[model samples]
Target chain A: SQTIHQWPATLVQPVGSPLSLECTVEGTSNPNLYWYRQAAGRGLQLLFYSVGIGQISSEVPQNLSASRPQDRQFILSSKKLLLSDSGFYLCAWSVLKGGGYTFGSGTRLTVV
Target chain B: TQLLEQSPQFLSIQEGENLTVYCNSSSVFSSLQWYRQEPGEGPVLLVTVVTGGEVKKLKRLTFQFGDARKDSSLHITAAQPGDTGLYLCAGADTGRRALTFGSGTRLQVQP
Candidate 1:
C-alpha cells in the first residue's frame, strides 16, 4: 500500500521568514505529486504539480514555489513568508494519468 | 479555465436526515470525482464517476454523473454524525492534467 508523509504538523513563523515543507511517498515510483493550499474550511487551491523529477508546474503565481528533488520527494518552499501564506498545506500523489489521488495528513502553518 | 461550483456552501442537519450536494460546471469533464475531508486532514477520494449518467452507490451514499458530463451530485441517505465533513467535487478537464476543484460544501450532521 502507498502512503504519504508530511512534516511539521503545525508551525508558527514570523513574517519574512523562510519556509520549507516536505512531502514524501512510499510504495510508488514516478508518481505525480501536487501541492495544494486550503483556506478556512474551503476548497483547495492548486499551488504546484510535478509529473517527474525536476519538473514543476505552478498553478498560481504567488510567494511559494515547489520542487521535486527525487521521484517521490516533493518540497514546497518560500524565501519570504507573507501573512496570506498561512493556511493548510496538503500534499497529494497520483499515478500518471489516473484521476484519483492519495493525500498526506497536511501541515498547518501560521504566520505570526 | 474550467471551474466547478458547489451549492449549499454550508449545511447543518440532524442525524438520520437525508441530504444532497451538487456540483455544477458549464464545461464538460472527462471524469468527475467526489471527496470527503475531515478537519485538519486531507480530502479523501470517495468515488469516481466516469460515464455520463452513471450512478454508483457506496453504502448510504449515491453518486451520479450527469448525462452531459458537466455536472454531478452526491446524495446521502439517513445521514449520520460520521458523515459530517467537507464534501468536494473535482473534475478532470479535457486535456488538462490537474483537476479543477469545486468551492466545496461543508456538511454537519448533528446527533
Candidate 2:
C-alpha cells in the first residue's frame, strides 16, 4: 500500500520567518502531488500541484511556493511568512489513472 | 472556472439521526468524490461516483451522482458521533489532471 508522510506535524513560526514543509510518498512513482491550505472554519484551497519533477502549477497566488525535488518528494516553502499564512497544510497524491486522491496526515502551521 | 458548491455549510444533529449533504455545480464533471476530514487530519476519501445517476453505498453512507454529472449528494443513515467531521466534494474534469473541490460541509453528530 502507498503511504504519504508530512514533516513537522505542527509548527509555530514567527512573522517574517522562513517556512519549509516536506511531503514524501512511498510505494508510488510518478504520482501527482498537491498542496492545499485550510484556514480555520474555511474549506481547503489548492495552493500548488506538481505533475513531475521540477514541474509545478500554482492554483492561487500567495506567499508560498512548491517544488518537486524527487519523484516522490515535494516541498512547500516560503522566504518570509505572514500572519495570514497560518493554516493547516495538506499534501495529497493520486495515481494518474485513478479518480480518488490520498492525503497525508497534514501540518498545522501557526505564524505568530 | 469550474466550481462545486455545497449546501448546508454546517449541520448539527443527534446520533442516530439521518442527514443529507448536497454538492451542486454548473459545469459537468467526469467524476465526483466524497471525503471526510477530522480535526488535525487530512481528508479521507469516502466514495467516488463516476457514471451519471450512479449510487454507491459504504456501510451507513450513501453517495449519489446527478444524472447530468453536475451534482452529487451524500446521505448518512443513522449517523454516529464518529461521523462528525468536515465533508467535502471534489470533481474531476474530463481532461484536467486536478480536481476542483467544494467549499465543504461541516457535520456534527452529537452523542
Candidate 3:
C-alpha cells in the first residue's frame, strides 16, 4: 500500500514570509507527484507536477514553485507569500501511466 | 485548456432521497474520475470511468460515461447522511498528464 504524507497539517504565515511545504510518498518509486491548491469548499487547481527527479511542470504561474529533490520527495515553496496564496494544499502520487491518484492529508495554509 | 462544468453547485436533500450530479465538458477525455472530499481534507478518488457509454455501479452509487467521452454523471440512490460531501469530476484530456477538474458540487444530506 502506498501513502503520501504532507506537512505541516496547518500553517499560519505572514505576508512576504517564505514558505515551504513538503510531501513524501512511501511504498512507491519513480511515481509521478502533483501539487494542487483548493479554495474553501471548491475544486482543486493544479499547481505543479513532476515526472521524475528535478523535472517539474508548472500549471499556473504564480507565487509558487515546486521541486522534486528525491524520487518520492516533493517540495512546494515560495519566496514571498500573498494573501491569495492561502488555501488548502494537497500532494498526490500516481503511477507513471495510470490516471488514478492517492492524495495526502493536505495542509491548510492561512496567510495573514 | 479543457473545462468541466458541474451542475447544481450546491445540493441539500434529506436522507433516503435520490440525487444526480452531472459533469459536462466539450473536450474529449481519455478517462474521467469522480472524487469526494470532506471538509478540510484532500479529495478521495471514488471511481474511475473509462470507455464511452460505460456504466459502473458501486453499492448505491452509479456512474456513467457519455458515449463521446465528453460527459459523465453520478447518481446516488437512497442517499444517507454519510454520503454528504463535495463531489468533483475530473477529466484527463487527450495527451495531457494533468486532469481538468470541475467546479464541484457540494452535497448535503440531512438525516
The Cα error of candidate 1 at residue A52, in Å, is 0.3
Tell me the lDDT of model 2 at B34.
Answer: 94
The CAPRI class of candidate 1 is medium
Find the 10 residues in a row with the least total lDDT in model 3 chain B.
B92-101
What proportion of true contacts does candidate 2 retain? 0.51
Tens digit per residue, CA lDDT, model 1, B6-111:
9999999999999999999999998999999999999999999999999999999999999999999999999999999999999986687788899999999999
Ranking by DockQ: 1, 3, 2
Whole-model lDDT, model 3: 0.93
Off by over 4 Å in 3: none
Where does candidate 1 chain A have its weakest 10-residue lDDT segment? A94-103
Identify the runs in model 1 with alpha carbons over 4 angstroms from their true place.
none
Candidate 2's C-alpha runs over 4 A off are none
Q: DockQ (Cα-based) per candidate?
A: 0.77, 0.65, 0.71
lDDT scores in order: 0.94, 0.92, 0.93
lDDT of 1 by residue, A17-107 (tens): 9999999999999999999999999999989999999999999999899999899999999999999999999999999554798899999
* TM-scores for every candidate against the unseen true structure: 0.98, 0.97, 0.98
Q: Residue A7 of model 1: what lDDT?
A: 88
